[model samples]
Target chain A: MIAPLVIFDLLLALTIVALAVAVLCLRDLFAMIVVFIIFGLVSALAWVRLSAPDVALAEAAIGTGVTGALLLKTLHHLRYVTGRLGQNAARGLTAMAPVPVAVLLANAAFCGLITLGLAVAFLGAPAAGPGFEGLVAQAMPQSGVEHSVTAVLLNFRAYDTLMEVVVLLAAVIAVWQIERGLSEAPAPVMGVVWQGFARLALPVIVVVGTYLLWVGAEAPGGAFQGGAMLAAVGLLLLLTRAYVPQPGHRGLARGAFVLGTAAFCAGGPSGGQRGPRGL
Target chain B: MLEGFGAILIAMGAVFFVAGTVGLLRFPDIFCRLHALTKADGLGLALIALGVALLAGTAGAAFRVALVWFFVAIASATCSHLIARYARHGAGGVP
Candidate 1:
């Protein structure tokens, strides 16, 4: 008999695969987005089951929460644009041509072959090897952080982390630029219940974000998780129209966007100087 | 004994969750579905959180679990309300 834990794992994996198929097959944009979000949440659970709470938190916050909201926003924009065009245009967009059976079979066969190959490769690999865990543990004292993951991310591999932050900054800037071209029609005011909830929850969200950032030195939390939490707060504010940006708010917003990259860059040289291979 | 009790509570919570899912699938309309889901799942989650907290056996862990339950309750309530409102009135206003 299969162990209960193994059965749970199998079910979770099946659910993820089913969600992926549903997301692809669902023609309705809203339904597809919802399925994708469910996929993210299920994957997050899988991560937790694999004993990777850090990844689970990140997946839940960024992959499911923020990305799902963004997709919904995109759908709203698409509807607006399509509505402006005509009903015919919207219908044309939705009425995509069905894929041929032969192509579908070919794709499935290819995917199966790839999966088989990966399974073989994984099975053929050595059961044990000198992995980075030992090296990380050896260097942990020098890294100055209790959490090995954070130590590796922020100290040993600071350059990679810095580059990631820079990329995020660039993406934010790009999005801002694109958004500037869009119509500045005021967002509809949410109901009083939502407004009240947002007001009550915003401060709590900030506190949680700060806690996540602080806990990274010793636990499964970090800048990415914290930033995603803050982003959720921003989404809430925008949804409620409680923190609408004026022309004067642009400077402050830009500064906040650049702060992470700036701090990383400033810290990089100092950290490098303390290392054995000083740059 | 506490662990066993916690396990039982968790099992009960799972039953409620199953009930909620069934209601979600079988309910006639969006509002009805939302009604079934929010009420059932909120209580289900609270029970689950309580079970986990009891299993944890630490004040700090229980507090954290309670905080998670609080946040999830707020989010679920607010989301259900918004969805029901949207279904009833549409995006712009009452049609």
Candidate 2:
């Protein structure tokens, strides 16, 4: 409503529109990837604006950070392969007359349907079941946890969080196996600077991660948050080739990856089902 | 008073996000595009998270949102690394 804020919002909106247009118009595949990374960041910002910090965080980490990296790598590989072997190339020939128009029409129809469905869903906000607000309030008053969501995630829905951890571990294992199947050993890049920094940073990161996990019972943190931090360390290690991920190297990575799930699963049945805590 | 600031922060974040996207689209080369995305996403999310944290009266709510913020950062960074590696190794780009 203020003039400056309104101006800011308009600018943001314009930028998003411009980027989308540019991404669609760009001829180069690499340019498209770059556009997508920008899109991820913009979306994260949008999430924050919408009063969802958690979503924003996830968007930043998973969307822009991880997904952008993945896309860029893929594009780079494609470019390299194309340059060397010239294997994959888009054909310049159109099979039939008016094919472009027909293709456009089909895409338009698909977009229309998706847009309509999303709009309709967003417009509807039916009354939910027994509200968690009441429960959360009660729990807060009695429980030791300072964070409501942390309480919900760890105490109420501990089992779900646990399983989620397992899923992450499974995914990491799959990635490792895929690379291993290709006969790629953990090619550890050697450098005193890289190794030294990693050695220093790893311990600090680990300590922070552990603090997050341990404080979850009564703080604004938990396993999911902690696990992600821990995973980041592995990711960093992998990046510099500090800790080479070999074919069977499944000790710390494996444990950290699955710790949340293991904890959750172990808590369930043994602690008796109290409420809903599914991931 | 705080509510007004929250609104301002949120709006500013959105602008950055859009700016990042535009940069990404306009930038030539994979690395340059990545730069746009990382900068935009990190700032945007932080602003949004800050707003949310302010709105959250309880510590738990704030924590939950913060957790999301933390995870998003980790995930995004990791993905970027993967993409870079794929390009370098699979495509034979410089490591």
- Model 1 chain A lDDT-worst window of ten: A270-279
The local distance difference test score of each candidate is 0.79, 0.64
Model 2 over residues A103-173: C-alpha lDDT tens digits? 99999999999999998876774556575788798878555567776667656776576665566656666
Q: Which stretches of candidate 1 lie over 4 Å from their true place?
A: A81-130, A268-279
True contacts kept of each: 0.39, 0.00
Best by lDDT: 1
TM-score of 1: 0.86
- Winning model by TM-score: 1
How big an interface RMSD has model 2? 6.7
The TM-scores that each candidate's chain B achieves against the reference are: 0.94, 0.88
Docking category of candidate 1 = medium
Give the C-alpha miss distance for residue A250 in model 1, angstroms: 2.4
